[model samples]
Each structure stands twice: as structure tokens, then as C-alpha cells.
Target: MIKVGIVGGTGYTGVELLRLLANHPSVEVQVITSRSEEGIAVADMFPNLRGHFDLCFTVPDVDRLAECDVVFFATPHGVAMSMAPDLIRRGVRVIDLGADFRIKDVSLWSQWYKLEHTCPDLVEMAVYGLPEVNRQQITDAQLIACPGCYPTATQLGFLPLLEQGLIDHRRLIADCKSGVSGAGRGASVGALLCETSESMKAYAVAGHRHLPEIRQGLSEAAGRPVGLTFVPHLTPMIRGIHSTLYATLKDPKDGLQSLFEERYKDEPFVDVMPEGSHPETRSVKGANTCRISVFRPQNDDTVVVLSVIDNLVKGAAGQAVQNMNIMFGLDEASGLGIVGLMP
Candidate 1:
């Protein structure tokens, strides 16, 4: 069994990781850390995991974490960079579900995250953990940078078109809406039930942090820097992301559907819905799957694609587990055969 240690188990992502890894056939949760919640039983904090995990939250210790085969940092951005270097030196593989190692350019990452990176070398060495885009790199990487919820949904929705050159890379628009859980489990007035319910409004139009990450991935796929207008909104729901993307068709590509189908035919998690279908966020809720469908209304020069994912699943913890599976040579679906929850 792969012995696993998790840092910062107080947030939504951390708990979600515990929930998924508990059922993994080849995984054993060895240590979990939380400065504030130290000594508390995992079940006391999350009732859903009552019987599965008998472990308790403890304060983080590098020596203890280094003993595990792999360590997952479910903490915020700066936390991982501060500690991951030590773990990696001790021969432990590291996976960060934060913004620390996701961006290649250290300066840009600092500007957006407002924290100077402590390990620029690791930033360059870390593999962007989008399994569909960098599966091979992940298998050999000691440090994996998992993509954020917005970047995951956005990049998957745009990759097929950009790779096939079916759309004008110079012009792209991503209008996305996400559940409040994307805000994390922190205490904030903006995330209060009264504040978010019965209303929806876009935030960070001036340029969100995920903009550069998305651009970096899209640019990599298109083989050049691409222009993208990414706008994100907070919906009243609990846990999903719906990305509606737009692009100008380069020339009436007849096989856009076939292109997408072929591109993701063998992918275990990305499901390409039939042409003209509109995928629903609820259909992918709690599952590590991105269901996508394409449309060309009136056969016009414009193309629209709808993509949906459970933000906490394919968007965060579940994706981290998928990367872990690849890194350890385990079946990609080892503990991730989750059926989406429906109403």
C-alpha cells in the first residue's frame, strides 16, 4: 500500500482528499496535519468519513511527513513551497493542490499570488498535473502541480479546438460560473449563505489569477500565445463549475465533433457527449469527470462549447488522486470510480 500524508486537513480540499483516498484499494492514510485542529479525530471534523478514518489531525512535522511514500499539500499556496523542498529531498513525492508550482514563470506567479516563490527550480521541474495534457510527465515527476478548478474546466474545454486549429486562437472567450465551495471552506462574508444565494455576479473581470495559468496551458496546446478573455462568476449552488466557451471557427471545420471525439476517445475521465448535447453540472457532481458537448448554432462561423465538472472532484482533490495513481503506477481509476451524484 502507498503510505500517504496530508498537510492542512481543515479545508474543503483536504477533507475531500480524505474522502476519496479512504476507498482507494492501494492507499493507506498515514498522517494528516492541521495546526489548529491538531489532536482532533478526522471523523469528528467530517461526519461523512466517520468510520473510514481513525486518524487524527496533528501539527505538521517535516520528518514525520517525509516517512510517507507520498505527501499531499492541501494547504494554501505559500505553505507548500515552504515545506515541499524538504519532503522531495527526503525521497518523498509531493503533490500540491495549490497555486505554488502550477505556473512556470516564477515572477508572474509571484505577481499574481503576491508571494515570492521560494523554489524556482522546483517550479520549472514540477509537472502541470492536468492528466490529459501531461500524463507522461506526471509518471516521472517527483513534484506535481495540480491545476485549479477554473483552469481545469477552461483548459479542457478549449484544448481540442486549439490543437486542431479549428478556431481562431487570437479570439476566445470563457464565461464560467462556479459553486460557492470553490471559494474554499474559509469564513468570509462573501461566501455566506445569505450573500450568495438567490443571486449571481461576476468577479475579477480585471484579470483573475487563473487567467495566466489558463493562458499558459492554452498557449502550450496551440503552440503559440493565444488571446483569451476569461471571466468567472460565483453561483448559488454548492459544488460544480460550468464553463461556456466561445471561439471563431477558423474555416468551417466539418469534423469538430470527430476531432473532439478522437482527441478524448481513450481518456477515462473526459466524456465527450454527443454533438448538440448540453452537459449539466449536476450530472457530473461528485464525480471526477468532465462532460463536454459542442455546438455551432445556425452553422455560423461561431462555435460554442459547454463543459461541466464537480469543482471539488475533477477540479481539485480527485484530480490530485488521479495524478497520484499515475505517479505510483496504479490503475488510473483505482479509487476514483465515482458515479456522479444526481437529484
Candidate 2:
């Protein structure tokens, strides 16, 4: 069994990791750290994990974390870059569920995050942990930087077309909407009940942090620079992300549906819904599933694809554990076999 440790166990992503890991047959949660909630039982912070994990959270210690076979950094952006280096030096594997090591360019990471990277050399060794595009790299990687929630949904929506050169890369527009939980479990005034309830608005229209990550992924897939007009919105719901992607098709006669189906035929998590099918956020809620549907939108030159996923699941924690399973040579969907929560 692979022994695992999680740093920053008080947040949404941390608990979600425990939720999925609780049922993992070949993995054990050996250590969990929460600087603020140290000594508090993890079950107290999350009643859902009452019987699964009876362990209390601890403060992060690199030496202790290095003892585990794998450590998951569920902390803020800068924490992992500092901690992962020591862990990696000790031959311990790491998966960061933050933005620290996602971008290859340390300057871009610093510019977007507004902090100088503490471990820029390790950035070259960290794999971008999107299993669909970088599965082999993830399996062999010592360090993994999981993609951000918005980028996860947006990239998956655009990856197939961009990789196959089916779309006009220069005119890509991704308009994404995510629930409140995407903001995290912090006590921000903007996320309060009154402020978020019965209201919806777009906050980062100019430039969000996920912009660079999305651009990087698409650029890699297209083998060239791909322009993007990425706009993210905050919805009133608690979970899920729905992205509408618009790109002009290079060939008006090429069947978009057939192209998407053929591209994703081998993928387990990405589900291409039948032609003309509009997928709902609830349809993929609480599962590591990305449901996508394609349309021509009255013009053969333009293709619109709708992608939906539980932002907290496929977009974050579930994907993290998925990366862990792949790294450990286990089935990618082992403990993540949650079906959508349908009413």
C-alpha cells in the first residue's frame, strides 16, 4: 500500500482528497497537516469523514512528510514550491493541487501569483498533471502540478480540437462559469451567504490566473501559440463548472461530432455526449466526469462545444487523486467511481 500525506487538510480540496482516498484500497492516509487546525480531528472539520479517518491534523514538517511514499500539497500557491523541493530530494513523490508548479515559466508563475518563486529549478522537473494530455509524464514524474479548476475544464473542452488542428486556433473563445466552491473554503466577504446568494456576476474579465495555464496547455496541443478570450463567471450554485467554447472550424465539411468522438475514444474520464445533447452540470456532479457535446451553431465554419463537470471533482480533488493513482500504477478511476448526484 502507498502511504500518503496531505498538507493543508482544512480546505475544500483537502477534505475532498480524504473523501476519495478513504475508499482507495491500495493507499493509506498517514499524515495530514493544517497550520490553523493542527490537533483538531479531521472528522470534526468534516463530519463526512467521521469513520473513515480518525486522525488529527498536524503542522507541516518536511522530514515527516518525506517519510510517506507520496505527499499531496493542498495548500495555497506558494507553499508547495517550498515544501516539495525537500520532499523530492528525499525521494518522496509529490502532487501539488495548487498553481505553484503548473506553469513551466517561473517568471510567469511569479508574475501571475505576484510572488517570486522560491524553487524555480524544480519547475523544470514538475509535470503538468492533466492525465489526459500528460498521462505518461504523470506516471513517471516525481513531482506533479495539478491544473487549476478553470483551466481543467477549459483545457479539456479545447484540447481535442486543438490537438487535431480541427479548429481555427487564432479565434478561440472560452466562456466559463463556476460555482462558489471554486473560490475555496476561506471566509471571504464576497463568498458570504448574502453576497453570493441570488446573484451572479463575472469578476476576472480582464485577466484571471488560469489564463496563462489555459494558454500554455492549448499552445502545447496546437504546437503553436493559440489566442484566447477567456472570461470566467461566478454562479450562485455550490459546485460544478460549465464551459462554452467557440472556435471556427478549419474545414466546414469535416464532421465535428465524428472528430470529437474519434479523438476521445480512448479517454475514460472525458465523455462525449451524443450529437446535439446539452449536458448539465448536475449530470457530472460529484464525479470525475467531463460531459461534452458539440454543435455547428447554424454555420459550418463555427463549432460550439459545451463541457460540464463538478468543479470540485474533475476540476480539483478528484483529478488530484486520479493523478496519484496513475503515478502509483493503480487504475485511474479506482476510488473515484462516484456517479453523478442526480435528484
Candidate 3:
């Protein structure tokens, strides 16, 4: 069995990781760390895990984590970078579900995240953990940097167009909305039920942190620098991201649907819906899948693509487990055969 260790096991992402790993046939969760919640039983905090895990939360200890075959950092930014170098030196694979090593430019990452990066060298070495985009790199990487919730949905929506060089990369736009859980499992007056239950508002219009990450990925796909306008909104629901992407088509072609279908036909987690389908966020809720649809509105030069994903699943924890599966040569769908949750 692959021994696993998790750092910061109290947040929504952490517990979500625990929930998925508990059922993995080849995985044995060894250590789960939470500085503030140390000594508390894991099941006591999240009743859903009661019968699966009997372990207690422990404080973050690098030595204990290094003993495991792989360690996942589901903590906030900066927590993973502080200890990743040591773990990697000890020959342990590392996966970070934060913003630490996602961006290639350390200076830009620091400017957006507001903390100086601890390991600048690893920034270049860490593979971006999008299985559809970097599956081969992830298979041989020791450090994996998972994409954020908004970036996951937005990038998947825009990828097919950019890859074909059919869109004007300079005019790409992503108008995305996410559920309140995307804010993380934290206490904030703004996140209170009364404040968020019935309202929707857009934030980070001027400059959101995920902007640079999304731009980097799209630029790489277009083989040039991409000019994108990304705006994120908070919706009234709880666990998904819906990204409505707009791009000006350089060539008015009739094969847009075929383009998307062929591009993602073999990708396990990306579902390119039928020609006229509008995918809903709830369709992908609680599952590690991105449901996407493409359209040329009015048959004009403008194209619109819709993408949806469960922020905590395809966006965070579930993707982390997917990366772990790839790195360890296990079946990519071994512990991730989760059907979407619905009413």
C-alpha cells in the first residue's frame, strides 16, 4: 500500500482529501496534521469519515511526513513551500493544493500572494498538475502544483480553442462564478448564510490572483503571450464553478464542435458535451469532471464556451488524488470513480 501523509487536515480541502483517500484500494493514510486541531479524532470532526478513519490530527512534522511515500499539502499558501524542499530531498513525492508553486514566475507569485517564496528553485521544477495538460510530466515529477478552482474551470473551457489557434488569444475573456465553498472553510462575516445565501456579487475584477495562473496556462497553449480578462463571482450555492468563456474566432469555421470533441475524446475527466448542450454546475458536483460545451453564437466570429466543475473535487482534493495516482503508477481512476451528486 502507498503510505500517505496530509498536512493541514482541518480545512474543506483537507477533509475532502481524507474522504477520498479513505476508499482508495492501494492507499493507507498514515498521518494527518493540523496544528490547531491536534489530538482531535479525524472522524469526530467530520462525521462522514467516522467508520473509515480512526486516526487523530497531529501537528505538522516534516520527519514523520517524510517517512510516508507521498505527502499532500492542503494548507494555505506558504505552508507547503516551507517544508517541501526537505521532503523532496528525502525522496518523498509532494503535491501542493495551494498557490505556492503553481506560477512559474516567483516575483509575480509573490506580488499576488503577498508572501516571498521560500524555494524559488522548485518553482521551475514543480509540474503543473493538470492531468489533461501535463499527464506525462506528472508521471515523472517529484513535486506537483495543483491548479486552483477558478483556473481549472476557465482553462478547460478555453483550451480547445487556443490549441487549434482558431481564436484571437489577445481578446480572451473568462466570466466565472463559483460557490461559497470556494472561499474555503473559514469564518468570515461575508461568508455568513444571511450575507451569501440569496445574493451574487463579483469580486477581484481589477486583478485576481488566479489571473496570472490562467494566463500562463493559456499562453502556453497558444504558443504566445495571451491577453485575457478574467473576472470571478460568488454565487449562492455551495460546491461548483461555472466559467462562461468568450473568444473572438480568427477563422469562422464549421468544425468547432468536432474540434472540442476530438481534442478531449480520450481524456477521462474532461467531458465535451453535445453540440447544443448547456452544462450545469450541479451536473459535475462532487465529481472530478469538467463538463464543457462550445458554440459560435449567431454563427458570427465570436465563440462562447461553457465549463463546469466541482471546485473541491476536480479543482482541489480529487485532482490531488488523481496526481498521486499518476505519480505512483496506479490506475488514474482507481479511487476517483465518483459519480456526480444530484437531487
Candidate 4:
């Protein structure tokens, strides 16, 4: 069994990790840390985990974490970088679900995240944990930086077009909307029910942190720097991301559907829906899946792709588990064999 430790077990992503890892046949969740909630039973804090986990929350301890085969940092950005170096030296694989090591360029990461990177050297060694793009790298990585929720949906929507050199990379646009739960399990005036409910608005229009991460991935795929306008909105729901991507087609082709279908045919998590289909975020709720659809309206030069995923599942915890599966040579779908929760 792969011994797993999760740091910061109180947040949405952290608890989500617990919910999924609890069922993984090959995984044993040994350590779950939460500095503020030390000694509190994990199930007491989150009733959803009452039966699955009988562990109590402990303070973040490097020694205990390093003893595990893999440590998943579901904490904020800076939290992982500070502890990762020690854990990595102890031969423990580190997977960060935050933005600590996702961007290769430390300066760019610092610019957006507004904090200096503690382990810039490790940033170079950290692999972006998007199985569809970096499956091979993730398998051998000592440090895996899981992609953000928005980047996951947006990148998957645009990857096939960019990789095939079929779209104009300069004018790419990702108009994405996410549920309130994406804001994290924090007490905030903006995230309050009275504030977010019955309302939809965009934030980070100037430049969201995920912009650089998305551009970095697409640029690497396109073999050239790509320009993207990424705007994120907060919806009234609880757990999902819907990204409507737009790009100009270099040529009006007939096989766009084939291109997407063929690109994700072998990928276990990415579902390329039928042509003219619009993927809904609820379709992927509680499941680690990205449902995608490709379209070229009126046979114009513009191609639109719709991608949906549960922000906490495929976006954070589920994808983190997927990376752990690859790192440990287990089946990629080992712990994530769950269907979306639909009504």
C-alpha cells in the first residue's frame, strides 16, 4: 500500500483529498495535519468523513510527513514550498495542490502570487501534474505541482488545437466560471451565501494568477509563446468549473471533432463529448473527469470548445490522487472510480 500523508486537512481541497483517498484500495492515509485543528478528530470537523477516516488532525510535522511514501500539500501556496525541500531530501515524494511550484519561472510566479518563492530551485524540478500533458514526467517526478482548477479546464479545452497548430494562439480567450466553493473553505464576506448567491460576477480581470500557468502550458504545447485572455467568474453553485474557450481557426477544417476525440481517446479522465454537445459542470461534479466538446459555429474561422469539471475533484484532490497513482505505478483510476453526483 502507498502510505499517504495530507497536510492542511481542513480546507475544501484537503477534505476532498480525504474523501477520495479513504476509498483507494492501494492507499493508506497515515498523517493528516492541521495546525489550528490539532487533536480534533477529522470526522468531527467534517461529518462527511465520519465513517471513512478515524484519524485525528495533527500539527504539521516534517518528520512524520517525511515518513510517508508521498505527502500531498493541500495548503496555501507558501506552505508547501517551505516544507517541500525537507520532505524531498528525506526521499518523500511531494505533490503540491497549490501554486507553489506550478510555474517554472519563479519570477512570474512571484509576480502573480505576491510572495517570494522559498524553493526556486525545486521549481525547476517540479513537474506540472496534468496527466493528459505530462503523464510521463509525472511518473518519475519527485515533486509534482498540480495544476489549478481553471488552468485544468482551460488547458484541456485548448490543448488539441494548439498541439496540432490548428488555432491562432494569439487571440485565445478563456471565459471561465466557477462555483463559490472554489473560493476555498474560508470565512469571507465575498464568499458568504448572501453575497455570492443570486449573483454572478467576474474577478481578476486585470490578470488572474492562473493566466501565466495556462499560457506556460499552451506555449509549451504550441512551441511558441501564446497570448490568452483568461477571465474567471464566480457562480452561485457549489463545486464545478465551466470554461468556454475561443480561438481562431487557421483553417476551417471538418474533422475538429475527430481531432478532440482522437486526442483524448486514450486519456482515462478527459471525456470528449459528441459534436454540438455542451458539457455541464454538474455532469462532472464529485468525479475526476473533464467533459469537453468542440464546435465551429456557422463554419466560421472561430472555434469554440466547452470544458467542464468539478473544481474540487478533477481540479484539486482527484487530480492529486491521479498524480499519486502515476508516481506509484498504480492504476491512474485507482481511487477515483466514482461517477459524478447528479440529481
TM-score of each: 0.99, 0.98, 0.99, 0.99
lDDT of 2 by residue, 1-343 (tens): 9999999888888888898899989988999999898899998889999899989999898888988999998888889888888899899999999999989988987889999999888889989999989999999999999888888888888888898898889889999999999999999999998998999898889999999999999999999999999999999999999999999988877477888898789888999999889999999889999999989877668888899998888888999999998998998889998999986
lDDT of each: 0.95, 0.90, 0.94, 0.94
Q: Which candidate, 2 or 3, has the higher lDDT?
A: 3
| Residue 264 shift from truth in candidate 2, angstroms | 1.2
User: Which residue pairs clash in candidate 1?
Assistant: none
Cα lDDT tens digits for candidate 4, 1-343? 8899999999999999999998899988999999899999999999888889989999999999988999999998899999999999999999999999999999999999999988899999999999999999999999999999999999999999999999998999999999999989889999999999899999999999899999999999999999999999999999999999999999897999999999999999999998788889888999999999999999999999999999999999999999999999999999899999877
Q: What is the lDDT of candidate 2?
A: 0.90
Tens-digit lDDT track of model 1 for 190-248: 99999999999999999999999999999999999999999999999999999999999
Better of 1 and 4 by lDDT: 1
Candidate 3 regions with alpha-carbon error over 4 angstroms: none
lDDT of candidate 3 over 1-343, digit per residue (tens): 9999999999999999998998999999999999999999999999999899999999999999999999999999999999999999999999999999999999999999999998999999999999999999999999999999999998888898898899999999999999999998989988889999989999989999999999999999999999999999999999999999999999897999999899999988999999899999889888999999999989999999999999999999999999999999999988999999885
Query: Which pairs in model 3 have colliding backbones?
Result: none
On the 0 to 100 scale, the lDDT of residue 301 in model 2 is 84
Task: Indicate the TM-score of model 2.
Answer: 0.98
Return the lDDT, model 2, position 257: 85
